[model samples]
Target: MTVLTEPGVDAAASAPVLPAGPSQNARARRGAPSWAWLGLVPFAAYVILFLVVPTVLSVGSGFFTEDGTFTWGDVAALGDPVVVQTFANSAGLSLLTAVVGAIVGALVCYALLGMNPEGAVRSTVDAAAGVLAQFGGVMLAFAFIATIGIQGVVTVFLQDALGIDIYAGGTWLYELPGLVLPYIYFQIPLMVITFMPALAALKPQWAEANLTLGGTRASFWLRIGIPVLAPSFLASLLLLFANAFSSYATAAALASQGSQIVPLQIRTALTSETVLGRENLAGALALGMIAVVGVVMALSSLIQRRAARWQS
Candidate 1:
């Protein structure tokens, strides 16, 4: 049926209906507001001033000689036997602490999981983990000394009470064994803090389903729990490794004899009274440490992505 219509009615209907506002894609492409960008200013300034500047200076100094000329001499020193051994010692110490911490911390997390989430025990452990994770440096060293050192409370009590000497085999606590104890002291708490969230993310529905399907508890863990948790576990291990690898003050205070690990070596290179031309050497050693930490963190991030997929 033909009917009279308003002028431009056909044109209006035929024309494309453009959006009343910008498309989401367009708005997203336009990015955040200017004021929102200001939020990053403080973080950027912090990285620039503290991390980036120091890292660049260290790396740049590694390539320069004592005479201020570009040279590979300092880099070459990194290949020396002593330097190689120091790196080995650091790697071994980090590995030992990471493994020990991961195992013990995982056990502790499992114990906590069985308890009421809001219980006093869980809350106290969480609070203690938070504080102990940050307890390091000279203070941590002193605490260990006061508790287990030659004339420490425990040492004296054992000596008088049982006539047994912990230092009978010599002062091993002032060596690698000693350093391992302190490193693990902090690493275990740090591991708990880093790993507990992932452990808590396990869904009960999956376990219920497995049991309903006639799967035993051991089988469920073998097939589901371990597979789901492996990434998070490895990531936590890498974090522990990096934490131990970079620690200095505790080792410095305990191992007062010489540079037993890379950090101590770097400290000696930078601060030795008789040493000359070692400033650049310190930079080279620091660069090596940076490379190790960078690799560890990179692997950690990749594993965390895998872990996130399961948790999500």
Candidate 2:
């Protein structure tokens, strides 16, 4: 078994050589044509045009008069009693809907957790959630009106069948209180869509380990499950809150009699000539919304990052 090799060559050179430095994928990416980055151009342009430009215009308008003269008057509208009350109403509505939606949706996710991931029920639910999450606006409002409005099918049925008066006090369905049901309607589906993945990411081994240590089912959830999912739950809650806060069409359609929330208030500011010398007030309200939503989304991103560590 004599082996011959060049005297000057290193023996290690003949050994199975491992590629050094960057990976094939990395090198291929590095060598890619510069034109490849152009794929992002359309998306970047879209964001700049739709998001960046509108945000800047909206925020900037808040500090200027209708004549383009800079003034703090418009900004001061944020402190107005009416504006403040509108914001409070919107926040309260959003909070209520978010909490309700998160709890109900979390329960739904838990129910689905033990089911086959690809089963008929799960598939149908996933499809329905995806659709319903985006199912707000005038169409939803119209559906509600057709089903439960004054003289509508359900209203008539309840009045005739059970002697019930849904509107005995007043037309609550066309008021601020009315927006709650519709807001929660879409919020639940959205919560389900966002929170389900986090639920699915919970490793079965964690539960097994808890049981191995002589933990009861209740104890396992209280000690391990709740702590692990808390971040994700909070993130989804914030997301739902933001979704509800920014909702306009459903509220607009249902509560057409008054500006009861921030979005509707903005609509009033833009449409009404009664509020003289404050035409730019809508911009101020918009800025307020942007600030609130921005803070919430930032918090959500941070919590999502924490939750992702365990999933990864």
The candidate that wins on lDDT is 1
Q: Please write out the lDDT profile of model 2 over residues 223-262, one tens digit for every residue.
A: 9899999999999999999999999989988888689999
Clashing pairs in 2: none
How much lDDT does each candidate structure score? 0.92, 0.91
Give the TM-score (vs. native) of candidate 2. 0.90
What's the true lDDT of residue 69 in model 2?
Answer: 84
Across 196-280, the per-residue lDDT of candidate 1 in tens digits comes to 9999999999999999999999998899999999999999999999999999888998888789899999989988998876788
TM-score of 1: 0.91
Judged by lDDT against the true structure, how good is candidate 2? 0.91
lDDT of 2 at 295: 99
